[model samples]
Target: MTLEVMARCSAAAMAALAVMMAVGTDTVGQDTETVKPDERSKVSQYGIRWTFSEPRRVGRFVNGDWWVVGPATVVSVTPKPGPAPEDEVTEIKRNQFGDAAHQDDRRMRNGSMIVIKSSGRQGYDSRVKSYDPGLSVQFPRPLKPGQSLISSVSHTSLPNNNFSHKIMW
Candidate 1:
């Protein structure tokens, strides 16, 4: 093989290796799956709550953040649904560190926020008195079996404030 040809081949091989390293492989055990909470609880690290209602969807974000989605329920309640068809609520919990910052930055840059609202009779009657991070928000009243709650968060900053006036959900 000519020296020039060998050099070109080596360069191509190196490029391929660089790309592979950039996109690392996912190890089965290394990837943690999001699991629905058996009951209503707060994830202290991220200041998010896990409300497990019917039909749970648990998985890690693309960035390896853990989250559980189910019906939004009241934390004060007891003996709630657990891995049963009868459960019909869902809440999403993101517990990974930096997830909030990344989400917040994305929302802020995009000039949008995520609003999570409640559903059913419980949501209509019960209001979210307050919300806090790393703590569960206490409800004035217990959520009914089929009720849900919703909340929203928006990004605070944008580049050049060009899209500041625009609203994003």
Candidate 2:
């Protein structure tokens, strides 16, 4: 088509779009509205804000599993270093953590203990039933071009495993 015809068609399309938009929103918006954030995700399992430091690509695993596996640090917004036990170490409390590591355990701002548990295969929570510890060379899930291994989504096991063992005096 000629340039003049193309320009007329474009102008006509724009005019039609404007008309549709005007017709769609007869009931407009309010001037002011109160907004609030989601309360569910406000705090992490540690009873405080926590996140993984920006992980850099160091290289993949030998078996071709992960693209990177370098030293990742846990940055605690409010790192509460638990007081060293002056008294003799009693029966190391396993109730406050997922794994039975006393030395790696620390308390939170809300007096809740945070235990560091190493993830087993591919971030699969070891405590759960049927988990792949990252490297899945054996039972590889058959995925399409746009598909992925859903079971491969490994989330770090939260301290106390979402249950509280707080003893009330």
Candidate 3:
């Protein structure tokens, strides 16, 4: 190969290596913050809890930090019609990590925040003639083994207190 061509090729390879190294540095410490399968809790509604056998990662932010929590079974509560059905109640009761699972959609209970990660029947009552109310959730940190988690069923809404301002000309 010609000297100039070899120099250009070498420069291109160096540039590629530099890019890879930059990305590698960004992910260097990610594994330590990651939640292992055993570190994740077996969370279920009605207070059933356990750890996962396979490691799982949940959410990832735009900056690349991952949600360090379980990829276990997450059941979300859906809006129920008048005279809530048994299955509806059961689904809500099964969302052990509702608070962590529903952080994105702002699903709340009492004064606490609850969010769901799954949608469709995974988080709602199929029999209810209602729109889907599932949410996308993201947990803040890794959960310990056998950690106790619960879903929030009671929903509280802010009262409409917007007052109109009058402009006098």
Candidate 4:
């Protein structure tokens, strides 16, 4: 490559590195703030509609990072009705991490944040798989066994949001 092209590439990489370092240093030692008792105890509702993936059952399972001290229960899961069952499929996975697997257990339980992840992986080309316009969600209270329901999740990417947005300096 020419010197000019190499110089430009080097500059861009350095800029990205600096951003990561600054952001990493700021949050390295901090902990997720404690959430109020009311927030954890109360129930909220949001309806979601999106294509989802099913993970293969491995072996034994354990309570993961997203498990809080609440009475949360999954009612049911059904495929989208009609011929086109998978109009919005993203991807599928072999391992089921469970919700909140990426966050700390304590923080996920009693914190203000909710961490949601896609079951499947996205393709190399980001634009081709844009999951349509969107759908409104109503995340409701925990359900009972007798009650029947379907689960759906939605996610969107912010421009240039693949990396940390928080900076230290």
TM-score of each: 0.20, 0.18, 0.20, 0.17
Q: Relative to the true structure, how large is the alpha-carbon lDDT of every model?
A: 0.23, 0.23, 0.24, 0.20
lDDT of residue 87 for candidate 1? 28
Clashing pairs in 3: 41-50, 42-50, 45-94, 101-115, 102-115, 102-116, 103-115
Query: Per-residue CA lDDT of candidate 4, range 1-169, in tens?
Result: 1222212111111100000011122132357553322223212223322111221111111321122222243222122111122333333222244422121111001001011233222111122221111211123324322222222222221122212324411
How accurate locally is residue 139 in candidate 4, as Cα lDDT from 0 to 100?
A: 32
Model 2 C-alpha lDDT per residue in residues 53-167, reported as the tens digit of each score: 5432222224432221213223332222222234423233343345442222221111111112323212122222222233221221221222122111111222332112344
Off by over 4 Å in 2: 1-31, 34-42, 45-48, 52-124, 135-169
Candidate 1: misplaced stretches above 4 Å? 1-37, 43-47, 50-138, 158-169
Q: Which of 1 and 4 is ahead in lDDT?
A: 1
- The residue ranges of model 3 lying beyond 4 angstroms of the native Cα positions read 1-38, 42-169
Candidate 1 per-residue lDDT, tens place, 25-95, comes to: 33345567533332224321122233333333334445433344333333422212112122222222233
lDDT of 3 by residue, 63-90 (tens): 4322324323332222211223333222
What is candidate 2's TM-score against the reference? 0.18
